[model samples]
Target: MNLENLRREYLKGGLHRDQLADDPIVQFERWMTQIIATNIPDPNAMTVATVDADGQPSQRIVLLKGLDQRGFVFYTNLRSRKAQDLKHNPRISLHFPWHCLERQVKVCGIAEPLSAAESLKYFVSRPRESQLAAWASQQSRPISSRSMLLQQFEAMKNKFGKGEIPLPDFWGGYRVKPQRIEFWQGGVHRLHDRFQYTRQADDSWSIERLEP
Candidate 1:
């Protein structure tokens, strides 16, 4: 497979330092708004990377549940691999790949569990079916077969039987408090534009442009 010529020129646009918002969170929201306006599928989908106790790393795609000054938030089974990893090591990274816009946002931070009240608030907003499924699946665990999984789902459906499903004890959300964030915009001739925002000791952000 001689596939050395698989590439496309990024002529969409170029990013200027002046165009960036003073606050990275504000800039992230602006970019997110543009992405949502377009037809791009799952605009909030992001790659979350975590490391195990042994220092081995793992990555997975998760939907962004909430975002604010506190930081980015996502929910998952508290007993999942990612959750276990976070328990051992809070350090984590997140990457948003907005390929259609030729833009990317990389975030590095520590993962902290959201309050039970906060988790329950989002849990109740989920669809009934999703709520039931959340109880049935033991994420990151091996399953016997598809039939067995569906059986568990069916069992949960019957148990709930039109009643509001409660939040699973082993399920909740995590907030990533970002220490650093980098925004990248693809440019022609492989000269990309990159700007990084680092959190200062006084909670202020120090922005710097990095060479591509």
Candidate 2:
């Protein structure tokens, strides 16, 4: 594989300043809607980054479950490695790269766990098998073998047996109330368009153009 040939030129999509939104959240919604309209696969997938106590960062892709003006929300086992990192350091960053659209959005904020009622509501809406699997898998834990997981899954199925599975105390959602948002659009010769919206002391947002 030739590393140099791996590059491909980006055609000017003509996405300019006039296309931007004054409110970042509204802009986000508009772009997200456009993504959906484009029929891209897994548009909700995003890379979530969290820092450990040592200030080292870790990142993984997670499905976006909810979003609003307040924050972006995602669900996972509360005791997973990511969740543990959040416990030690609430600050997190999320990135959504829609390569097909030649656009990306980066968000940074603090995370907070959702309420028990919210977790339970979402939990019950999941498929029975998924609910059982959630109960069986100790997320991020090292398992001896795949067979052990199958056995545990079967055991959980039997225990829950067509009954309402309770949302594990170790599983729930977190909302990242963004302090900063950056929108990037591809341009000619890497002179990309970058705009950032930062939250001010008075809770209003201030927008500025950034050098790519």
Candidate 3:
């Protein structure tokens, strides 16, 4: 199969500077709302990129659990590779690929661990099976077999039978305080429209257009 032949032109509507909100967060929220309205699969899914102490970069898809003025939030096991990387270096990047809309958003920021109380609040809201799975699995660690994993899951289910499953001490969330955000809208002939918001000293944002 010739992979180079796979190509499609994007002709989605262009993004204008006048359409941008003064705050990047607000603009992001608007885009998210549109995506959600379209019934897109896993609209909250985002690619999180982190760098290790050795300068090796790793990326994975993580659900955007919460978003507000603070920034983007996602959860994972504290001992996971990504978590460990963030522990050593808080700098991280996030990418939201809204391909159906021919748009994407990129965020660069510092990741900070969410408070225990905040993590607990979201944990309890998750489905019971997911809660149990969280307790059973050691994320990013090698396991023996499928049966062993199921056995652990069953054991956790029984342990928390007929009661609330407490949040795992090792499982929690991180908030990425974005220092820069870029919104891209694909245009005809591959000439995309790109606008970037850079954080200012007064916590405001300065918007700039980038040549595509």
Candidate 4:
């Protein structure tokens, strides 16, 4: 496949200062609404990047389960590899690449575990099979075979026995309260539009343009 031959103009849109919301959160919500309106597949998907204890970097795509004015929230097993990385270094980054729309948003922040009650609420809303799988999966741990996972799932099923499946102590949600949020819009000849909102000491935001 010749990658260079596949270039198509990124004429989907443009962003201007006059059109941007003064508040970054509101600006983000507007873009989110546009994504939703365009009916892009899995618009909530984001790449979560973390650094391990040894300063090694890793990243993977995760669904954006929840968000609010405070921060962006995602859930996973606290014992997973990414969770271990967060345990060592709470500073994290998230990227949303809406390629079809030629747009992206990057965020960096400190990650902190959400309240236990919040975790339980989301856990209870999940399907029964997912709940059992949550209990069965020893995330980031070595396992011998697929049969072993099935066995564990069956065991967990029996243990719960049509009862409430308690949220595992090792599983929960984390929110990344953004200190910096950058919005990127692909433009002609790679002259992209980049605007970043940096949090200030007084809980205000300072917006700036970045060289692209």
- Give one digit per residue, the lDDT tens place, for model 4 in 17-75: 77778788899888888898889789999999999988899999999988788999999
lDDT of 1: 0.95
Q: Model 3: residues >4 Å from true position, as ranges?
A: none
In candidate 1, which residue pairs get closer than 3 Å at backbone N, Cα or C atoms, i.e. clash? none
lDDT of 4: 0.92
TM-score of 3: 0.98
Q: For model 1, what is the alpha-carbon lDDT of residue 39? A: 80
List TM-score per model, in order.
Answer: 0.98, 0.95, 0.98, 0.94
Regions more than 4 Å wrong, model 1: none
Q: In model 4, what lDDT does residue 170 have? A: 91
Model 1: how far residue 166 lies from native, Å: 1.2
Model 2 lDDT tens row, 1-212: 67876765567474556777777889999989989998988999999999888888999999998889889989999879899999989999999999998889999999999999988888888888889888999999999999999999999999988777888888899989999999988887877889898999987888888888
Decreasing TM-score order of the candidates: 1, 3, 2, 4
- List clashing residue pairs in candidate 3: none
Give Cα-based local distance difference scores for all models.
0.95, 0.89, 0.96, 0.92
User: Clash totals for all models, in order?
Assistant: 0, 0, 0, 0
